[model samples]
Target: MKTTGKVWKYGDDVNTDVIFPGKYTYTIKDRAEMAKVALEDLDPEFTKSAKAGDIIVGGKNWGCGSSREQAVSCLKERGIGAIIAKGFARIYYRNCLNEGLPIIVSSEAVDAIEAGEEVTVDFDAGQIVTKKGTFPFPPYPEFVRGLIEDGGLIPHVKKSLGLS
Candidate 1:
């Protein structure tokens, strides 16, 4: 699979609290509503400016706080094409995969990419290309790609079972 988009850069240690904010959890049950406040604490204009297929690039330890699934859900709901981070909190990484959000671990790309620059990620080829340069990384395993392609674990499992 491949995706191309303008980048949205963020710093290290972006926690779940900033991603979804615990304050709204109780009041917001709808994914689209939750997405409106996504990264609002960090970048108040994100919801207004970000578009479908835009990528998020971040520094090391991205997603380092709580394991709130909304962090992943919010990004998905907002139509983030993928996230490229120097590193990821283990739980958040798994959560992204579980929610069918494409996330790549690429310190090189994270360090090199600038916010608003156009980028292309080739998942099948494991490469990220930009005006600056091209960076290569390992591609996701087939099973994981299958999960994402099928729109997360539940759908993947259901497909495996011929349920949907």
Candidate 2:
């Protein structure tokens, strides 16, 4: 799979509350509405400007704090195609995969990328291409790639069972 988008850069230790405010966790159930508040506390302009397939580039400990799936969901709902970071919180990483939002770990790429620059992620080749250059990351296993392609775990399972 391949994804191309403009970058939305951020720094270290960005927690779940910033990704999607904890206060709205119980109130916002609609996906589109969830997107509206995404990064409101961290980057107020994000919800206003982000377009489908825009990429989020983050520094170390990205997605740290809490296991709120809404954090991942809000970004996914906002049409964020992928997240490239120096590192990720484990639960948040899992949450991204579960929600079909691609998360990548590449400190090199994160450092090289700038906000508003366009990038193309070639998942099949495991390369992140930027004007600075191309950086390599390990390719996802076929099963994992399949899960993302099918839109997370539930849809993948349903497809495997011929129920979708």
Candidate 3:
């Protein structure tokens, strides 16, 4: 898969609470509603202005804290195409994949990508193309990429079983 989008850069240790505030974890069950409050605590404008296909760039340990699925779902609901970080909290990384949110870990790419810059990510090529230059990261495995392409684990499974 390939996507081109504007960058929404952030820092390290951006927890699940900040991504999708805990206060509404139980209250907001709908995906659309959850997206409306995404990044409310960390980047309020994001909830209002982030466009479809926008990419999030982050420093080390992005998505740290509780194992709230909302954190990943909200962004996916908001139409985030992908997230690139220096590193990711283990569970959050898995959550992203399970939710069909592609994530790339490339400290060099993270350091170079600037907020608001239009960048193109070629998942198949494992390249992030910026005006500055192109950076390469390990591409997802074919099976994993297929999982994302099919829209997460459940959808992929259902399709494999001829249920969808």
lDDT of each: 0.89, 0.92, 0.92
Question: What lDDT would candidate 2 get against the real structure?
Answer: 0.92
Clashing pairs in 2: none
Regions more than 4 Å wrong, model 2: 160-162
| Candidate 2 structure quality by residue, lDDT tens digits, 123-154 | 88999999899999997778878888899988
Q: What value of lDDT does candidate 3 attain over all alpha carbons?
A: 0.92
Query: Which lDDT tens digits does candidate 1 get at residues 42-94?
Result: 88878678888999998888888888898889889999999999999999998
TM-score per candidate, in order? Answer: 0.94, 0.94, 0.94
Scored against the true structure, residue 122 in model 2 reaches a CA lDDT of 92
- Residue pairs clashing in model 3 are none
The per-residue C-alpha lDDT of model 3 at residue 83 equals: 95
TM-score winner between candidates 1 and 2? 1
Clashes of 2: 0
Clash count for candidate 3 is 0
Alpha carbon deviation, residue 135, candidate 1 (Å): 0.7
Model 2 alpha-carbon miss at residue 57, Å: 0.1
